[model samples]
Target: MNDSADVSTSPDAPPVTIFGPDFPFAYDDWISHPSGIGAIGPEAYGQEVAIIGAGMAGMVAAYELMKIGLRPVVYEPNRIGGRLRSEPFVPGEPEVAELGGMRFPISSSSFYHYVNKFGLRTRPFPNPLTEAAGSTVVDMNGESLYARTLEDLPEIYAEIAAAWDNALERIAGFSQMQDAIARRDAPEIKRRWNQLVHDWDDRSFYDFLSTSDEFGKLSFRHRELFGQVGFGTGGWDSDFSNSMLEILRVVLTNCDTDQHLIVGGAEQVPRRLWSDTPYRITHWPVGTSLSSLHNGSPRAGVKAIRRADADHLEVVDSYGVAKQYKAVIVTCQAWLLTTEIDCEESLLSMDLWMALDRTRYMQSSKTFVMTDRPFWRDVDPATGREVMSMTLTDRLTRGTYLFDNGPDRPGVICLSYTWMTDSLKMLPHPVERRVELALRALDNIYPEVDIKSHIVGRPITVSWEADPSFLGAFKGSLPGHYRYNTRMYGHFIQDDLPAHQRGLFLAGDDVAFMPAWVEGAVQSGLNSVWGVMHHFGGQTPVDNPGPGDVYADIGPIDVGD
Candidate 1:
């Protein structure tokens, strides 16, 4: 790790991308003495493990593998937590801010592991009860509208939520049978997921909403909530699946452990995980894009393009100065990885590419408005009282986050807004479009106040999802998509390596699970580690099973049908 911190400056003092105690961990013969720094050893898994993209998933998997006696070599082009970037904002310098994956919902098991082991500071991120929707925000029809709380909301809309709850109990009750059928075959799974749950893959949220009682009861809310407020309609209609709704109930509702906020931001999670590890993390600037993916027997080759037109991965870096791992666990957004990695014609074959296409990420257009003032100091919607902090920023910014920042922006409050699906891809470039979007949104909220005045400075529109290094903010699933992805992908295993060949299998958010956010990525990466470990023993470790079904982890996710 470099002492000088990796940050950007704008004729002003730059905030520190990395700060805190120095490289407190030791780097001994990590390649050989695997047990020195981390919990695991190189020989524990019978071979070395290599992970690419040091984001939450990659890093967490690293921690797990190390604990189980696997020496995993992590390969990250720039800073770890690929998109959990936090640019600094120094007074009189460059404009840098934190880039949180928005904010975190309760995390899955794997996410919890890495965060707690690191001992990250904690804060409360209680659910939202009230919010303030500004006049500048658009409605389902792209017209302006104002809102406060669910109760303060339009009476018709309130009745819909009540209806939705009633409908949800009836519909969600049927999910149990659907889960069982989904595992049996695609057609049967599609039937339930599409008709009862929703037909998301080929339809819009609008089209799918009508199929469910919840939406039927909340017709008004559906037209506005799912159509314009939540997932957005176009991308959902254009390219998505009905499976998202059900899966989300599972994703958002359950977590491995209790949920809380990272005091400083998400950065503390990875920063601490990197602690006591043999491999060192060298932070770089905002220039990390992949170029190609070549299969070298057991070892897959990856090429990247950095800021200076320099090579990113080892394949791109000559003389192989880039570290080569026996196995690579890719952790960035799949689309970003796709751009840099070459899919051989065979890999890109219609059968394969079609599957790849199904696993694409959703686009976003957002701005993080930082201020020195106590912005979220308005009336509390959940309770008509003085509000301090909560999740209701959605009401305040029309579903955009308005409390403090993600690891990308530490301490300061940020109001985040995004357009799901194709609406995002239509936005302008970063430099011009990013700031413009923030200012535009701010102008609406503050109206006559030159909101820029409180601006210590931020990357307003840090288009990380669009960054070649990361295709989108996070991965979402369509109906029946995970079936093909997990069963088909992650099939390339290290043990499948030719007798004398040295290779590593890679897995991450994009590899399986249809979606590529924190949960999916961490789970997939964990699967990769076990797969490599299984390769060595000719069988899976006693603790885990192959294919890594979450149901397998917790003895089948109860459908409650």
Candidate 2:
């Protein structure tokens, strides 16, 4: 009973270089595939599968499992959606602030599938000075410049953008890599991407920028300004110390472009999945949902996971309630396995433990204030310019976004989305103090605009590093962490894992090729679904290839090489 499904490639198949540089993975292929990812026999059907965390990954896994005729009991201590949290400033109003993941790229097809299927509306996220964002103000060292378009910036800014483009072309074969990625040509992608991994895995992003001949020719001031007015979002100075591979993935996959924000809130995706009845299988009725399976409430947070027997695993909740399941999937942050939960040392191998323990998470803090109206849109009487613009600065308040809910309704303004040291600076402060500091910073950038007067409701703030469940904002792989990442990312395929270790699976953005994106979480969940199905003596349809199947044919980037 070989669970592995072999996929054959035609000898005459053309080289895969057509898909454009967005992430080449085709999740849409499987989601719409008939017969789904192989079904389990009647005996394995309806069996309880324990899923930890009710976040996007866990919920996505649970939803798919239910459709495949398995009961997935999810345990979550905090609210649903995990890092996709969107907190409301005023209760029962559409005016809300994204405390976690705010924007999503159009390239994340897997995530958009659920978004589109669930009937969720989305609007273009105003990243810096994008058209939808209206205008942008870049403030640096007591100086401010407003730009409605990239051309509006000084000529030097154009030079910086070109230097970055040339640097990528020179170092990473930008065009070929993008073409390979677009066409889903695994061989070309692996060849080009692996060369980057091998060369840049040990290099810091800052090092790559500084050493590039294109950037090296520019004055240091130009480099500083480049960091101040970064592409896509805002300043990326915080990511300077991270592995260059991380930045390349974001840029290459288009994760930083054509982004959109969920209209109502991102929380709606997981919240809807909790109770939405899309498909029924086996014991569950036509309208059976995840909530119905759990008796309308998620189980308490998992406290520990232990090997109850060779065939099953024991999971202990925060309340000391222990439950046994034939299979378990751990979708919580990787660090939670050691920091928050007291799991048996034997649950994961020493190597796996090293990967999980060594995982680095970048700290992030955000403060959002609700304004009476979209006051930032107001024009100055004397200056004849916008009083204030969606701001990017080197000050304490790093990036600011304005969410206009129209003229009359209240609007939300994300005063800051600070990372690393900046995030740490505000960790000890309270929300009001944080808001005050942000206001003071804004005041320096917009002395003419009285922003405080427009603020209506109490400001909301979050330091993701302070959250017990999530030890940090998201996985921030450092230089030389490629091997560790490969191990964790490939954990879904457990064919080589010992029988005792085969039941417990891992899935999340942290265990994905692209962390800090909802699509990564969704793709990881789908990978876990295939693995879980394979473990239960299931097989994938011939027309539909699972991740493992694809990986077998075209292996992951051998970064260790």
Worst 10 residues of 1 by lDDT: 18-27
Off by over 4 Å in 2: 1-24, 280-283, 559-561
Residue-by-residue lDDT tens digits, candidate 2, 291-384? 8888899999999999999888999999999999988999999999988888888877898899989989989999999988998788889878
Residue-wise C-alpha lDDT for candidate 1, range 1-561, written one tens digit per residue: 011111122346322110100100111112123232122233444344556667766766676565555555555656755566654455542223446543443434345545565566555443232222121132333333454344444565455445444444465433333233222333433334434333233333344457766566554545454333321111123232445453433322232112355555666566555554423321211221111111111123346422211111232321244453444455655554356654232322354456666665666555555566544444557655333332222322333444444334433444444445433543555544555554565455445445455555444555545567676655555555544454334444434433332233445656644243455555556556555555544343233334432223322112221
Assess candidate 2 and give its TM-score to the true structure. Answer: 0.95
Candidate 2 weakest ten by summed lDDT = 1-10
Q: How much does each candidate deviate from the true structure in C-alpha RMSD?
A: 12.7, 5.8
Top candidate on TM-score is 2
- lDDT of model 2, residue 107: 73
